[model samples]
Target: MARAYGFVEYGGPETQQLFDTPVPSPGPGQLLVAVRAAGVNPADWKVRSGRRTGSVTVHFPAVLGREVAGVVEAAGPDTGFRPGDAVFGATAEGYGGYAEYTLVDARAAALVPESAPFEVAATLPVAAGTAFDIVEHLEIVDADTVLVLGAGGGVGSATTQLAHAAGAAVLGVTSAGKRELVESCGGMWIESGDGFDARVAATAERCGAVTAVVDLVGGDVLERAVALTRAPERVVSVADPARAEELGGSGITRRRTREVFEHVAALVERGVLTPRVERTFPLTEAGAALELVESGHAGGKIVVTVP
Candidate 1:
């Protein structure tokens, strides 16, 4: 039996528990992976709380997590992976990364570069992948000024780095504690909170107008970001798609493919992108890890490592 953490029902953190289960078997186009690491995200908790069940239906005792990295233990037909091959990608539907073993769709999986560790590779499929989609969708250019709300978080930090690498000026809106982190990621730090829009406007005066806004924090924050840019079409929200659409902006549409994963992994290998893993918890501490991400204050990414 393999150890796993998951929710027994649709509810709060109280619904989560650790238990033992048989190692999952992979079917056609799937790979059973010995999960070395898993990246924690806000979406995990959202799904657990039943706030985001439209996309994926949860079974009772549903495991949590979407991205993972590890060595393949077995491969199903047409998967093209063998035992001991290092790989990472999104978990298969109804499967979760927060376990000793999980299944990944081969089409969405990529070989982990020798230079990239499992922890770093584990972060790509979701956070870095979403950032990539946002940058590509906006077609960020050197002349453009990009504003990243919640810049200190995983996706925000990745987006900031990618936009900066594309020669765009990046303004990262984050809490005061993450000023150093935002600046280190090649962004000009703009503190979030009351007068956030004013502060962003003041910075824009010096750095040029924000040509695009990447909203990782939605609701009023997204409203403020939309107002900062004249091209509302360039505004994209990963948090609240409905609100973004109402404001004339669209939501990020992910390209969850192996090619995208390979590209992001290559960036990590070349040191062009850093996963910036803030902390790692053991499998037993997965609950705390999710709580940190759900709190919306985690800097960079939180990973759960398995022994």
Candidate 2:
């Protein structure tokens, strides 16, 4: 039997417990990864806390992690991967990853650099996918200025890097502590505080004009992004879809997921992008990882380690 993390109830991180289950097998166009690391995200804690509920229509055991990196243990005939290929990507339907072994769709999994550790590769997929998708699909022009809310988070950071690399002036809203990190991503920092709008305006003025905004923060912060967008059509929101729509911003859930996966895979391979995994916990301590994500204060990803 393989040890994995699952939750039968929704409350908080403490509800997560490890269980023994048979290892999963690869099916057609599928892969079985000997999970080395499973990165944590807000979605992990949100799902656990029942705060962002759904995907639980059927009553069955639920695997809490979605992104993973590992060596390919096996692949179905339709998949081109070899037994030893190092792969990283998101799991389908949020079923697994906090386990020693998990199944991933061949399309979702991409070959990663062998030199890179499992923990780092595992940090890709979700945030990078979301960031890459929105920035590419929106087609932010060279002269356009892009805004990223919650620049301190995983998705926000990735968006900042991808957009800046694409030639857009990135204005990132974040805490004072993350200024250096965001700057490294080529983003102009906007601290989240009383003068947040003024800061963004100043950055836009300095850049001559703003264009698209790939907003990762929700609530009032997202509203602030809506204010700086030079063109209404250039606005794309990765988080806070409801608020984004209310402010005439388009949603990125349509293309960013797949786009993020593809773009980040290339970036990680070419050494153009990097994922910061603040900490890693053993599979047995998956609950602690979720607790850190729940706090919404982790500087980088909190990954779950496996065999």
Candidate 3:
């Protein structure tokens, strides 16, 4: 039996619990991984709370977590991975990374380099990968001034760093507590909250017009961020796609390919991007790790380590 943390139904934190189940086996083109670490994101709790209704059906007692790093205990046919290989990627059969063992689609998985730890590699698949997609899709250039909403979180911080490295001037909107974190990523910190657009506008008056808005926070925050940019088409969001589309912007389309994983991993290995893991919890404390992310106060990434 494998120990896993998951929700019994679509509900709040009360729905989450730790339980035991048969160790999942890899199907064709999948790998059975002994999970080393799992990265916590807002999506996990959102999916659990039923805020993200979609075509995907939820099986009761569904395990959460999208990305993970671990050792390959078994590999399915034609997966190219061997037992004992270190790997990280999105889970295959449901986002079930919150388990002692889970399956990963080989196509989406990447071998972890010796230089990077499992905890750090675990964050690459979702957080860093999404940031890379946003930067590429927006065609962010050095001349561009990009406004990053929710700059203190995982995807936000990675997006800020990638945009900054691309030569774009970044105006990061976050809480005053994460001011240093935003600035350290080569962004000019703009405190987030009510009247956020005003502060952004004042900052843009000095930096230049915001050519693109990479929104990690949706709702009114995204609506306001869109107003700052002239090229609303260049505005992209990960948090609220429907609203983004309604506002003339679009949601990020992920390229769940091995190449993207490799590129992001390379950047991390080179120290050009940092995962900025704020906290880690053991498998038993997975709920606490997720609570931090769901609260929207997490400074960077929160990961769950399985022992």
On lDDT, the candidate that comes out on top is: 1
Candidate 3 versus truth, CA RMSD in Å, comes to 1.3
Model 2 lDDT on a 0 to 1 scale: 0.77
Per-residue alpha-carbon lDDT of model 1 for 1-307, expressed as tens digits?
9999999999999999998878989999999999999999999999999987899868878889999999999999999889999999999999999999999999999999788889888999999999999999999999999999999999999999999999999999999999989999999999999999999999999999999999998999999789889999999999888899999999988999998998998888888898789999999999999999888789999999999
Candidate 2 lDDT tens digits, 14-130 = 567888868878889788888889988888767766766655321236678888988899888797788998888777554578888888887787777655688888888776777
Q: For each candidate, what TM-score against the reference?
A: 0.98, 0.91, 0.97
Tens-digit per-residue lDDT, 195-307, candidate 3: 99999999899989999999888999999899988999998988888999999999999998888998988898888898888889999999999998888889989999999
RMSD of each: 0.8, 2.2, 1.3
CA lDDT scores, all candidates in order: 0.93, 0.77, 0.91
Candidate 1: clashing pairs of residues: none
